[model samples]
Target: MSHHDNKPPKVCIVCGMPLKDKNDYPGGDTSLDWCKYCGTKDGIHPYKKLLEGMAKFLQQTQGMSEEESKKAAKQMVDSSPAVKMGKVKVAE
Candidate 1:
């Protein structure tokens, strides 16, 4: 079965944006195309971006040349709920 078959249909966890078509999320999962108003709400988008970036940095850098630093960063990133909320941008 496809990945989508296992998980429930995608919806914005915060704003209930329907993830059903290209207009909703042109780039698919990574698009993170929530309702326009929700995506632009004060202190939401930027914070989300920051958290997402941190998580990505941690995940990618983990167990690399600087193991300790990587681990520490990963720990910090994983500890924050916000960092875990955003969908990761998958490479195309």
Candidate 2:
């Protein structure tokens, strides 16, 4: 189970963006399962594939180095609401 379950449902499970943050989509509901970037009709992310993208995003947005982002990205993404809710799974 994901460790983010106890936290508020404020982060996008797909992109790992804080739903209440300034980056939220204007005129769109933040209550959705994901943010504007990663949030899609599927309401999920291909966990294994998404990890790489997320690492870069974290590098740019959070100011983490690429190496650091790559190392830490899994904890951030795996703790999202989608994973907590069983919306997606790690690829075998």
Candidate 3:
């Protein structure tokens, strides 16, 4: 069996961010599958909103061009655990 078989995933399902603390979760709910940036107490953000936020963060942190950051964000979200598990969907 996998090491994490019975444990919560160590990474956010939506953005693939490392979940290191309760503060990293939405409303400090450690049982959440997504991160603070990817969701709220209500639910996960819509796909476009999630992508835009991630792209902006990538551009700011990585010094990437707007187009490049958007591309990277889309790729990251598309391959995220949430998407793979059908918890989140990305349209091509």
Candidate 4:
């Protein structure tokens, strides 16, 4: 298969370590290059859609209020192991 057709090799942006399946880099936006750990440390993800959907799902599935759902989503994103290590920063 061509390089484009093959799955991108996962690499930790922080330490440049080869990531395992359990530590698969979150794939959503190209702009956010940092891995999960680093992303969390920086506080933001390339794809807000995934985070928003996760928040909505939590709210609907758990019968949480809008605010609560939002909070839950934020927490999930904040606590992500990848975010903590990836340290991705959104450009201004």
lDDT per model, in order?
0.45, 0.67, 0.85, 0.53
TM-score of each predicted structure versus truth:
0.28, 0.60, 0.84, 0.43
Question: Model 4 compared with the native: what TM-score?
Answer: 0.43
Q: lDDT per residue, candidate 4, 1-92, as tens digits?
A: 33443676556554244554434444533334445533443443464643576567768789988889877766666565445665433222
Off by over 4 Å in 3: 1-9
Q: Write the per-residue lDDT of candidate 3 for residues 16-52, one digit (tens) a residue.
A: 7887777899998878878899989788887888889
Model 4 whole-model lDDT (C-alpha atoms): 0.53
Span of ten consecutive residues with least summed lDDT in model 1: 35-44
The collision pairs in model 2 are none
For residues 1-92, write the lDDT of model 1, one tens digit per residue: 35566566566443345556544543333355453323443233454453454445545756434455544544543443334565422121
- Top model by TM-score, which number? 3
Q: Indicate whether candidate 2 or candidate 3 has the larger TM-score.
A: 3
Query: What ordering of candidates by lDDT runs from best to worst?
Result: 3, 2, 4, 1
